[model samples]
Target chain A: MDEKQFRDYLSSYTDAEKALSAPMRDTIRINTLKIPKKEFMGVSGLKMEPTFYENGFYADAGPGVRLGATWEYFLGYMHTQTLSSMAPALVLNPGERDIVLDAAASPGSKTSHMSMLMNNKGAILANDVNWERGSALFSNIARLGVLNAKVTVRDATRLGINAYFTKALVDAPCSSLSQPYAYKKFTPNLSYEISKTQIKMLFSSYDALAEGGELVYSTCTYEKGENEEAIKLLLEKRGSASLQPLGVEFPHEPGLSEYGKEFRKVARVYPQHFSSEGFFIAKLKKGSA
Target chain B: MSHVTTFREYLQRQFGAEVPKEIVLNEQEGVIRAYSKTLMMLKPSGYMGFVAGKVSTRGIEVKSEFAQLLRNPSRNVLALDEAQAKAFVESESVAIAEQGEGLRIAKFGRHVLGVGILKAGSLHPDFIGKGRKRVENSINP
Candidate 1:
């Protein structure tokens, strides 16, 4: 979509077009499993302020200071992630003793965060279809001292594992609409194909979830087809599943209700609202299958 | 039986520590992996991979990625000063004030970076690799 067309499409939401061009913020999450929040903040030299997420902080790193090179980072005490990217895991909110599945974990930003949240207590099946990405995920899991994670390379939609998980995160692959620089190349066909795959992945994730378990489906794109429409399709197919509100406080708009009432309860983070990347998150609860 | 005993003995000799009872040490082909019962259950079918580290003639040489999982601080651990810690992360060898023998876990403050070999007064931060460099860039940049 062109700038004008995109603006017209999101006419209902103020600043949606302007937010697309705004500079993104750099945010980091402290790995509480490895280090306490206060201790990590004391040692990290960067100027930072806490985000809505308790462990997350927006960092104003100076030109010479590389947040990734710090000793704390080497110790897996912190991860440089976008504030929006950190939401799905928090929304999923897997307990310390719950077995969780990271459906599309790669390079493991969310997987490692989930591991930290679980305090490395329960097992996490971190799977990715690509071999190269899977290796990156394994390395990150190891570097971050995530002992509870088991790496696997397989198509998430076709994963043959029979074991049911208490929680699951489907950070579906989508068009790079949220990426500030990728707006020029956005196309309708690409969005449709990604939406189809996302719906398939969601169905598989729901099947893997234990009855009465919860799952969070998220995408970085703001495209309604990839976000709200995909969730609507899943809800249609799986009658036992229903959307749940994400009870966290952050700057966000409700998911587009035109798709469904459940979508209205879902959450969307626009860049204009928080100086972060655009993201969509919908929490689903599975009833008896 | 003898091989298992030798491996156990090597673990004790190298780190001056004993493996936790919950962790089972298994040898496949030539690599040795330490897996808890929970980890074994979580393993995917047809998956052949190491959970802990590989067993080598030198000792049970832990993978760099698995280095942080080692909690037992032994004589093998070499705590570096601020300057040496910076250099060690840059993949540079630094001189230690006091010399230690054998493989050492290179630590900065309370955090373990990875393993290194100390001979004489010089410490070779061989464990510093892509992961370390990535960490270094995040801090130094």
Candidate 2:
């Protein structure tokens, strides 16, 4: 979007600039696959406060606390993540017995989080289209002691079919509208292109799910076209697809019904709302036989 | 802790490290990996699963990812004091006569620091993966 349009769009939110530009506290999701959350909460040094979500924490240890530099982090007991980003995995809630697909997984924040959610049981196929990102993804997965997820550098839209996965997550990439802190390079044309790709990824994710399984389509960007529009298109094209209310409870806006009434079930997070990042999440269930 | 398999057999013999049998171990480009059995069914194209060890000129050298994955090793452990523990996180070498000449699990208190080579009475630790420890962070040596 252009400057005026962008400001107009952001104008709806309270303290949009100040909140988005503000530096957020580091969020640590305790890797229960390694160290139990309760035990980690007892560890000293870093000042930790629990979030509303289970196992999510706001961690700080003075200036330059370097949570990333601690043995606890390196040993895979914890992973540094944004609180906003944690919501997708929590919403997906892949169980120990379910096979999962994480399309467009890179740097593996959500993918590894799903691995932890699965408790290292069942399986996950984490695919990223970029080679460099795949390396970082594998690094995070291995470092976090995530053994249930496998890394693949390939176009996520081309992944094998057969309704294999019980659950799927497409945290599709988008322009950094999520973080006004580092937000740039947003244009109507670019957003349209990206939205197209997001729809394709969403379709692939839904198709990858087994009949009766669920698919979660999420993006860091909140543009109507990127978030609600993508889901809207999926529901229209695939009659089997239907929006499901996010069983997850976190602070955020309800999805816009502009696309359709069911879009309200989608979760839309605005950075200004809680000084978190902008994110959109929607849970969809595939019709079963 | 009981792990004696082809990928990390030497570690089992050396440090009594335990690797679960459920892992489908495979060696890719000198590094040994343990993949999820269910994930392996898809035949992923790029990197997959956890790294167990590496194939060096001498033999399989189990890395710190293995220790971190397995968490605790039962034997051949070299416990480090404050000064030595500092050196371990910094990836430095310090002399320790406790463990015999070979690779041992370097420990600072009860936590595993990774696999270390204890040869000629000196220990060199390697905690593989991103985000290493800050030297300022202390451990009782």
Candidate 3:
């Protein structure tokens, strides 16, 4: 809120930790499914670097070019996303025809990434509580050339669909405290007391997941209440789901706070610490439904 | 792709505005589909799913929001009567309406479709499917 309050809230994090809060330059990944990478390079005058463990490319452009208005973007060859943000969907490791759930998916960046990872073979249910965002989600799905997903506008808690998913991404909305680093208008104070809703949303999302399914609980906030605490609460409620250690060379060191004794296995990411946004990703496997 | 190219050419010949270069076209069955965003821009990829098929001369299948634009092309000026609305929908004539924000056109389609444009001068995104039936049903029912 104010400068002193912002510093007090950020007091727990060191200067290096505070640096991770800055947002990286806007980057987009070029999808090769519809159009080749070369065509995208030619049209946008942007070069590409290989993505982390995916076929998509990392571009050196910003969103100002109206990339979406171009015929190339409309053709589904390119998608605007961040480098670090794309990790959760790839980590889910969904198989063909496996149903998936993207809880709190809006302005869908990760949900579409998951579909491309699945090669658009199976069904993905992208649910968001906000009705205003429902159509925008649909518009993105259609534009990306993804055929396997279905859109549903319902509160995250009322997601009583009969289908069971092999994987789910609960990218719950957090305090968005990490946004300040990415954009000037955002600050650490943004997430304070704002994560309570996200905790409730994540709890409802876990209820919709299935046995033997993998769930990647993620948030972009630096707060313990929304991150590990929420996962800890859900694990306690659903007793069958357990935290699985992440093996990937994640960009940050672990969080000092533990949601539960079992969540010691949880993996935490900080933007200043990880060269990306302040993110927390905890992988949970449903041993029983 | 063939059908999409053909359809694009036809639309360009009919309507002077050459469909922007980056909008991708997909053809499946007899319909032609156009999209404004890319696969990656789609966050929740399955959120809205995919288009049912291609756009046909009979009628194009669009989302409800897009359909609203096709039904009432006039931005804020509600036509005097159904006849005016019908004329707007039946003819692709662009009637400029200075509404709340700025100037936008009211476009008419084959069926009694009308749509309001914001500052962008582009059709609303979800203008597809049985927009006429929905608009009329909203009035009658």
TM agreement with the true structure for every prediction: 0.88, 0.90, 0.64
Indicate the DockQ of the complex predicted as candidate 3: 0.11
Relative to the true interface, what fraction of contacts does candidate 1 keep? 0.29
Q: Rank by lDDT, descending?
A: 2, 1, 3
- Calculate each model's fnat, 2 decimals: 0.29, 0.47, 0.21
Which model scores highest in lDDT?
Answer: 2
Cα RMSD (Å) per model? 3.3, 3.1, 12.5
| Candidate 2, A67-154: lDDT as tens digits | 7776577667788888899998899899988888889888998988998888787888888889878778877887787888877776
Off by over 4 Å in 2: A1-5, A12-23, B1-8, B38-46, B97-100, B127-141
Candidate achieving higher lDDT, 1 or 3: 1
Alpha-carbon lDDT, every model? 0.74, 0.76, 0.56
Q: In candidate 2, what are the lDDT values of residues B38-131, reduced to their tens digit? A: 6665544556686777766685577777676663478888777767877777777888876468777877776676788888888877665545
The prediction achieving the highest TM-score against the true structure is 2
Clashing pairs in 2: A1-A187, B81-B141, B82-B140, B82-B141
Local accuracy of candidate 3 as per-residue lDDT tens digits, B1-141: 466566555444422234444344565345544443332243443333445334565533333222221222322433324444433333333333433432123322222232333343322322332232211211110
- Where in model 1 is the C-alpha error above 4 Å? A1-14, A21-23, A161-163, B1-11, B17-37, B46-51, B97-101, B119-121, B128-141
Candidate order by TM-score, highest to lowest? 2, 1, 3
Which one wins on DockQ? 2
